[model samples]
Target: MSELLNTSEVFASDPSGLLRGLHRQPVLAVLRVSERQQAQHQLNLLVEAGLRHVELAVALTPAWVELAIELRQSFPSLRLGAASVRCLKGLAAAQSAGLDYVVSPILEPDLLAKAQQAGITLIPGVYTPSEVARAQALGAPAVKLFPASSLGPSYWNSLAGPLSPLPYCIAAGGLSALDARLWLESGVDAVALGGSLFETSQGPQQPLQLRPGLTALLAWLEQRANGDLLSG
Candidate 1:
């Protein structure tokens, strides 16, 4: 049998191996909600859709701690993480909440070190070579290329040539099903998609309604994973 990973050892060795192992499907569900009900509903939907990884942001009111604990119990196989974490306090809070990983919108050395010491995966945000280098030096498992749409796929392609040794980079911000091919081709390990994956017309007050859009997105991802379509 495969050796079990202790929660604290998730980032101890090859962080990319850990990330690839946790998020093998190449698509991650990023649920940003301000209400308890909404968070639960989205979690259920994503789980049903076969997504094994989800990230909850701390900025969401009502907080995601309770939901994270509940999810850990309900979906033992799912890898839970927290996003929008900007400081050491936020990292501690996320770890206390039973999160398997922590994601920040910006690279913070102190916070990264704290996360490493805590033994949780850290995916820090980076927009330039300096930021990526800093994150790599701090032992980040992956660097989130935020606002990737603004930088375009070429930026990732260019970085890959020089930072080939760096851990996987996840492309977030403005990612959509239509652009998955381009982003994946750009050498990113995976993509984090938000609003584009859900039907927002139902509003936060109501449970998220998965419309045809979500189905289409999933189908596209499935096809890509199956090698039916060019990954790029």
Candidate 2:
């Protein structure tokens, strides 16, 4: 059995084990709302619907740093992270805010190195096989495949091997409930869901609805857990 990393624990020497810990859940909800109240509400909804991992996209709100602090305090059990981190300053702010992880839309070597020095888990964004290799070289146990829909699942399938220390891929952008299964089947480690996973009928400010889309994701997790049932 793999030991769980405490929420407060900094980067361990073996970060791959940390990545594997996150992969156990395989779904990371990306919170991208502007209002602090709305973000809190959406986070509650996602948590209630069985999401244990989430990334708060910083660009979505001017008060993202404060909100990250508040959310971290509000939900002690949830693995909260800050996304859209563009530079060393952003990474430092996230770490200071007590976020459990950090993510970026672009791969920045300085930011990654600094995050490591700060003992924060940073998952940098990468799109191409070369970029993926670069991220792995930097010691990231996982990398976010931004605009994943642009490259599509087939492209991921092609990068199967040779990206050693091969970072686990988190598929983000242009992914819908239906498309998630394809990406997972194509060997992607996990999917980062944004606005599309919620119901739009209630307007953008309301808490997201977790049915249908979340249900599909849950089913996939169940199947993944029960390998015999899926394989047979």
Q: Residue by residue across 105-186, what tens digits does model 1's lDDT show?
A: 8998888777777667778899999898887777676789998889987787687667666567788988876676677766
**Quick one: best lDDT, which candidate?**
2
Per-candidate TM equals 0.81, 0.82
State, as a TM-score between 0 and 1, how close model 1 is to the true structure: 0.81
Model 1, runs deviating above 4 Å:
1-18, 59-63, 202-207, 211-232
Note the Cα lDDT for every prediction shown: 0.71, 0.73
